[model samples]
Target: MAICNQSQFKPISISPKTNHLSNFNLQISRSQTLLKCHNNNTSSLPTKTLKIEPLPLFTSVRSFAPATVANLGPGFDFLGCAVDGIGDYVTLNVDPEVQPGQISISDINGVGNSGKLSKNPLWNCAGIAAISVMRMLGVQSVGLSISLEKGLPLGSGLGSSAASAAAAAVAVNEMFGGVLSESELVLAGLESEAKVSGYHADNVAPAIMGGFVLIRSYDPLDIIQLRFPMEKELFFVLVNPDFEAPTKKMRAVLPSEIAMSDHIWNSSQAGSLVAAVLQGDLRGLGKALSSDRIVEPKRAPLIPGMGAVKNAAIGAGAFGCTISGAGPTAVAVTDNEQKGRDIGEKMVEAFWREGNLKATATVRSLDRVGARLISSNS
Candidate 1:
C-alpha cells in the first residue's frame, strides 16, 4: 500500500550532483506510478503492475520502521537493506490542544542519548518527517502530537534516525487515511534524513520500504527495490561497539576523488555483490562485500576495532563482513544464525582483545517488512 509524491520539503534540499546507481530506476509519481509490484509488499517492486493502498485512518496510530545497513559494500549512498527485530517506534495522536496543522514532540526515549534529542519539529527527524507528511496532505490546520521510541542505538550505523523518520512519516500518513503513496512516505523520511544525515536515501529508502532498495537517481527520486534470492536465507551479524562514529565524521573521511582503477575495481565488486545476492552465491557475496578498495579502507581505520573485527568475522567463516551504515558497528552476513553467532563471538572477542572496546552483538534475518503500522485506535 503506497503512493508517490512530488511534494518537496523546504530547508531540506537533495543535491543533484551525484552519479546514478547501476540499477534500473523506477519512478513513483503523485498521480500515477511507473514503479511496479506484485501485491501489497513494497519490497515486491520488481515487475508486476500494482495498485497502491493506504492504511486506515485513526485518531491515534503507532508505527515501526526497521533498522537498515546502508552502502551494502561498494554501493555507497545507493544500496541498503532493512534488518529485522530492531528498529524505532513512533506514535501519533491528534491534538486539538496544539495549533492546527503544526506538530509537537510530546516524548522521546530509547537507546542511546534519546534524552538529548531536540523537541522542535524543525530539528527532530521524526518531527520533520511528520511535518513533511502534513505538507503532502495539504493540511494546514490539523494538529498532531508525536511520541518516539528509539530502539536502534544512535550513531551506530544502523539507520537509527532513518527508522525514526520513517516511523513518524508513516504514522502521520496513517492518521489522515494513508493517502500518501509509498514513494511519498519515503520522500517524507528523506526530508528528515537529508537534514540530519547527508543528502542520501540509502538509509531511509530501505527503512521505509523494507528489504533491499537500490537508489537509481536522486533528482527525480528514482528507486528500485532489490530482493535477495527467495530460496536463500541470509542472516546478519550486527556488532555495535560502544563507540560513536557520527555520520558527518565518517562521511568526511571519504576521499573527494579516486583513481580510475579504484573506480573500476569497486564497480566490479558492487556488481558482483548484487549478483551474488540474486544467485545465492554466499562466497561471492562475502568477497564482494569485503572487497571495497576505497571507502572501507579509509573508514575502517577510523573505527578502532573494525579491521580486527572484519578479519575475525572472515576467520570465523562469515560469508562477508564490513562496516555497517557509517562505522563503529560491524555487520557480517551469513546463511545461518548459528554461524552468524559464532562469527559474532569472534568479532566481539577481537574488538576487546585488539581495539580494547566493548561491543554487543546481535543476529537477525533480513526484514521483508520495512515500516508498518504497529497499533491504532480511534
Candidate 2:
C-alpha cells in the first residue's frame, strides 16, 4: 500500500541546525563572485561552486550500517527506529586499473545464494548506492569493487537492504573525502532502495541517521531526527519466522485506498506515538504502536498465527507487539531487559507452536549510532 501522506497531518517544524550533518567538511559553503556580461553591461554576482578536493588514495574502506524497523505500526513509511546488534558491513576497494564509472561486486558473504547476486552495478544495492554517491559529488568517473557481509537476514523486516545501501553509500562517500552530507547519503541509499524495492526513506533514514526518524515530507525531503530517551531504559524483542515477507508482496495485498475514518485514526495514533516518545511515556507509546487500524489489519492475515504471537508477547509483559516493516518478523517492546528476553522467547514459541513455523528471537537495545566507518587501509 502507499504510505500515509504527510499532508494529512499538521506540519511539524524542526530546526535545520540540529545535530544531523548537512555538508561534508570539504564541500565549499561560500559563494564566489562571478562577472557576467548582460546586455553589454558587466554585472558582478555571487555564484555557488562545489569545490572538489583531492582525497588520499585509499586501498580499501570498510563501513557498517545498522538494521532498522520501519512503519512502527501507525506511522507507516514516516516512522522508523534502528536496531542494535544486527547490521550489514560493506568494504569498498578502489580499482584504478578498471574503467572509471564502473563498479564490480568482488564478493558477497552472510546472506545466502552468493552466486545469485549480480555483479552488475545497477543490480546490486551496495554498488548502485556507491555509484549514486559518486554522481552526487560530481565525480564523473570511478572504478571500485564492493564486498558485502550481510549480518541481518534477508526479508526479515530488519531493513537488510537499507543497511547494505547505507553502508555502501557511507563507505563510498568516505573514500571520496566525505563530500556528501548526511541527507545526501540518505538520498544515495534511497536510490539503491528504489531499485531494489520502492523509493521510500523510512528504513534508509534511521539506518543512516540513527535513533528514531520521522519522514515529515518526501518532497523537499524533510527528515526529522527524533530524540530517543536516553534516561529511560528500553529493550526490544525481535522474532523472525522461517519465512520471507517480500516487501512487494506485502504491499500488493494492502488496499489502494484507506477510509477517512481509518486515516484519521492512524494519524491520531501516529501523533500520540511521537508525543509519547518525546515525553518518555513508554506505556502510551506502546499503546499507540499497537493501535494501528489500517495496514496491519489487511496484512495480518498473510502472517500465520500473527494474532497468537502478538498476544503471547503482550501477555509476557511486552509494552506492545507489532509487525516490523513488511514482516514475517514481529517486534515487541519492554522496559526490562529480562522481561524483553522472556517476551522474545514467548513470541518465538507462539510462532512455532501455534503457527507451526520455526523462528528465532533476539533481544537488543536501540542503536544510537547509525552508519560509520569501521576501518580503512591506505
Candidate 3:
C-alpha cells in the first residue's frame, strides 16, 4: 500500500490550478459517499487463523519481516505475498525500570528516511503496532525499548511500513513471552497499518503470515493462505523507480463504480490468478496478473514509463508484469532467475530511456517464513 506521507499533507485550500474535469468529478463523488456507504453489515464471515514459531523467552529480541507485494493486479486490498531477502527489522528490549506497558523508541533509522520518520510511538507504524500488542496482552508493567532498521525503501509500493509493523509486532509479542498467535499478531500489525495506510490487510497480513494470502473478507479477517507447488519455480522481479505515489492521491484517482462487464472480467482474472497459485501455473498467473482491466488501467498512466516497461518485460519473456502495490515499482514474474534479471534490465532501461527515471531492480522468491526472531538475550 502507498502510505500517504504525513508531511505531504497540508491545509486544504482551493488551488488556482484547476483539476481536469474527470478528476474533479471523482473527488467530489468520493467526498460525498465515502462515509455513509460503509454501513457495517453484522453478517459475519468465518475467521481463518495462522500459526508462527515462538521465539525463546528472552530479555531482548530482534525480528525481521520480509517486504511484500500487494494487490496482485485484480486482488486489490486483499491478495499479497512476502518477498525474500528484503524487509525491515525491529529490536526490542525489556526495560523494567520504565513504566509498565510503555514502549520507548531508542532509534528509527534506515533506508532513505533520513530521520524523517516519527519517533513518537503514536505516529510511527512500528511503535503503534508494538504499543497495540502491549494493550492487547493486558501488559501492566513492562516497558520495552524499540529500535527500527528499515531495509525496504519507503513508499516504493513494496509494503515498507507494513514490514515495519510486522517486525515490530513480532518483536514485541516475542519479547512479552510469545502470547499472541500469528493471526493475533497480524491483527496487531493491522492496527498500526490502518492508522497510516488505508484500512487494508493486503500488505500487513502477508508480511506477518508469509506466503500468498487472500483476504477473503475484512469483516472477520478471513485469510485464505495459498502456496505454489514445491516443484514449480517462480521468481518476482521488482523494479522500483525513483518516484513516490502517495496512497491518498492514488486512491483519489479511482472511479467509484465500474460496469458489470468489467466487474465480471476482473473477477474471472482474480479467480484465475488464485487457481494459478494453487497449481503452480506461472503462465496462467502471469496472464491473470497482466489482464486486469480495472485498477491497472487507471494507475498505469500515473506512473511514468509503466506501459513501455511492462511491454519490455513481456517481450523479454516475462510471464506477466504489473504495478506492484501502488506505482513506481513495477513487478514481473518468471520461472528463471537469470531471465528475471534480464527482464529487470529491460525494465530498468525502459525507465531511463522512456520515463527518464532511474530505477533499481531485485529478483527474489517468495518468503515462506514471515516475521521471525533473529537474536534474543535469554
| CA lDDT scores, all candidates in order | 0.82, 0.79, 0.81
lDDT of 3 by residue, 221-289 (tens): 567778778788889999999988877777887889999999999999999999999999999999988
Best by TM-score: 2
lDDT of 1 at 278: 71
What tens digits encode model 2's per-residue C-alpha lDDT throughout 301-349?
Answer: 8999788999999999888889999998898998888888889889989
Q: What is the TM-score of each candidate against the true structure?
A: 0.86, 0.88, 0.84
In model 3, the worst 10-residue window by lDDT is 1-10
TM-score of 3: 0.84
Candidate 3: segments with Cα more than 4 A from true spot: 1-56
What is the descending TM-score order?
2, 1, 3
